[model samples]
Target: MSIKVGVIGAGGMAQYHIAGFKQAGAQIVAIADLNEAAAQAAAQKYGVAKAYGSIETMFAELPDLDAVTIIVPNKFHAPLAIQALEAGKHVFCEKPPAIDAAGVQQMKDAAEKAGKTLMFNFNNRARPESFAMKAYAEDGTIGRINSAQAKWIRRTGIPGFGGWFTNKDLAGGGPLIDLLHMVDLAMYLMDYPEPAYVLGQTFSDFIDDKNFKGPWGIPDAGGPTNVEAAAHGFVTFKSGQTLNLQVSWAELVKREEVSVVFQGTGAGGKIERLFGTDGLDETSIDSCELYTQEGGNSVNRSIVTEPCEDMGRSRSAANFIYTITGEEKPLNTPDQALSLMKVIDALYESAKSGKPVAC
Candidate 1:
């Protein structure tokens, strides 16, 4: 039977989820948004059977929802997911599961009590580069891991100064939350070690500036900008491996930088990505490369990119559906989300206190 899915948040991300659900052979029963017009439009565009102005009505009216995607802002992730799980539906949430660690825990507990899945969307884990690096790390092709460095720097991308993207109350944080793809990918590739601690710093120096605007933002004339525009942190795992991460929505740089590099005792590899017209197309996607000592000389070679039938967001959606339909199992569990949340929560705390925080 085709899974009956209802998606909340008729925003840009919801469109991707709608397409992905279709690709995964799930029937999109409804689209919900606070803006009823937006919900209607999305329902029509996605060929969904219904449009709801709120989750309450969606549940009260249509009780056949087998699954629901929580695509709303950071603040509502926990509550919405909890409600959905209580409703006995499988919940799939986008990245940065919640604003704080406690909220993620709540969602986790709720899912457990309901005997439902609480899969977090770390979609990049399925990307070619991320998948390849994971293989190298797990198979010991790179030996014991040493350290990892990843960054996603956007020179002038402050994502809607007045909207949820820039509002601390709405977005949770700036680049740390918005550009979590690279950071999450790197950590996922590293197998999400037990983080021991985090020392970090954040800055919102340019939030007041009207000159810098994001490539994708709803410029509402001018509004509040209360989140950090940049953040950098160092996380040390209990196993002694370390990860250094830096993310920025606005900076004084020539261009953007997005890469995940991992080092090990024996070999090292890196994947640098370039954005393209259609997201990360073949031309823009980086090749998985390895650097090591061959005989008496240094050698750098490219690994063959295996054919992946589904990847990125589509793969994530398909896998979620697969797990629900008993076709496959889930890779990103709520426990991993909770662990990742602990590190991020520590980073935010460390940034404010100017001290290292134990994760």
Candidate 2:
């Protein structure tokens, strides 16, 4: 049986989800957004049967929807997921799952009560390069991971400086949340370590420098901004593994880059560069070079590329439907998302207190 789906929000990301669902064989039954016209336009473009101005109305009209994709802004993620689960529909929500820890818990509770699947759209995990790295780490090819480093830097890429992207109340934090995919990927590759402590610092000096490049298409001289343009954090996991994270939007450099390095006791490997949704046309490197001391000689082994399943936004949406139909497990469960949010919360707390926060 084909799963019935509804999509909320008609933003840029929404199109990705709509296309993904269509490819996955799910029926786009309804679409809703605050802007009725935008919703109608998306419905027409995606061949959805119904369009509404709000989720409540859509749910009322399309009660048979097997799942709904919540593609709204960061703040609305939790509430929308909870509502969908309560209405007996599985939820595929965008990342950061919630704005804070409390919000994360509420969504988890809602899913538990409804006995429905709730997933966060951590699409980076679907990348072929990410899968290769995971396989290398899991196969003991990298030995016991001792330390890890991840970096996400952009030359001058501030988003919506005076709009919701820069608004603390709307988007939560700046690069911390905006570029959290790298952070989540690092943590996930490291076996989802429980941070024993976190020491972090955030900076917003560039946002007010009057020389930053805004990615959200917002003009300068609009108004004041209230979000960080760069952030860094040091985390010590309960297993004694350590991770260093660095992210930025308004850096004094060129090119947008993402990479992660893992140091193991016997050998170490690093992923130099990996393309994401931001640039699908670009070629991706799914290979890693490992260095090890074997038989008193420095041995370097280069693992070549292996075929991997593409689990982009569409694949994730399809997985949501499969999980709802009991054909597969959710790509990202509520518990896993809540854990990621907890790490995010700890990073912020540590930044504010100027000390290490225990997870």
Candidate 3:
């Protein structure tokens, strides 16, 4: 039987979820959102069978739904995911799992209690380079990664001056939370060691500058920008592993760059994406390479893979479908999301207190 799925949120992100679920042979049965008109429009556009104003209505009406894909804001992730899990459905949610660690823990507990699969769209892990890197790491080609540097920085790339992306309550803490893929990728490459402590600082130099807005077409929502424009942090793990993070929506930089660099005992590797036009993925170049000492001589070898257009957004969503069907394991677990959120929480706290915070 085909897996039946419902998508929450009629926003742009939901379109990716709908397409990906369909690509994996799941039947998209319904589209649900707070705005009935938007939900109806999305359902009609996608040729889905139903549209509703709320997930409660969708769940009440479609009892046979096998799963739900959540593309809502960071604030609603935990509540909606728990609701779906309690109603007997697997969940695939967009990241930064929730507004904070406590919310993520609640969602994790709900999924465990319900015995349902809960996965997040840590899409970078589904990229071809990431797949190859995982193989290298598992086979000890990269050996044990002791330290890593993760970055997603841009020169003039704030989503908008006053949109939800800049609003702390609706979107969490700007680029540190929004562009967290590289950080998560770094930790994933390190096998997700338990974080012990974090020291961090944030800057709001360009938070209110319209000149620093990104090239993406998100319109200004006309509100105060309370979040940081950039953040830098370092983390220490219980296993003696460490990670450095540098993320920003807007900063005085050369160009937009997304990358993760790790130093392992046997080899060091880097995965990077450089954008010709900031905030535009289509105008970007992706590269992966490894640095090692071969026969007492330094060697830098480039690892090639098929080009990725969406950075594994659709592929990661499809992985969720495959996981529930017993065909593949999920790319990310709820526990990992919880752990990542704890680190983020500690970083924000540390930034506020101007001191290191324990995770």
How much lDDT does each candidate structure score?
0.81, 0.76, 0.92
Instruction: Give Cα distance to truth, residue 224, candidate 3, Å.
Output: 2.5
lDDT of 1 at 180: 78
Instruction: Please name the candidate that would achieve the greatest TM-score relative to the true structure.
Output: 3
TM-score of each: 0.93, 0.89, 0.98
Query: Against the correct fold, how does model 3 do in TM-score?
Result: 0.98
In model 1, the clashing pairs are none
Comparing 1 with 3 on TM-score, the higher-scoring candidate is 3
> Can you write out model 2's per-residue Cα lDDT over 54-73, one digit (the tens) per residue?
99999888778888888776
Write the number of the candidate with greater lDDT, choosing between 2 and 3: 3
Residue 277 lDDT in model 2?
29
Mark the regions of model 3 whose C-alpha exceeds 4 Å error after superposition: none
Clashing pairs in 2: none
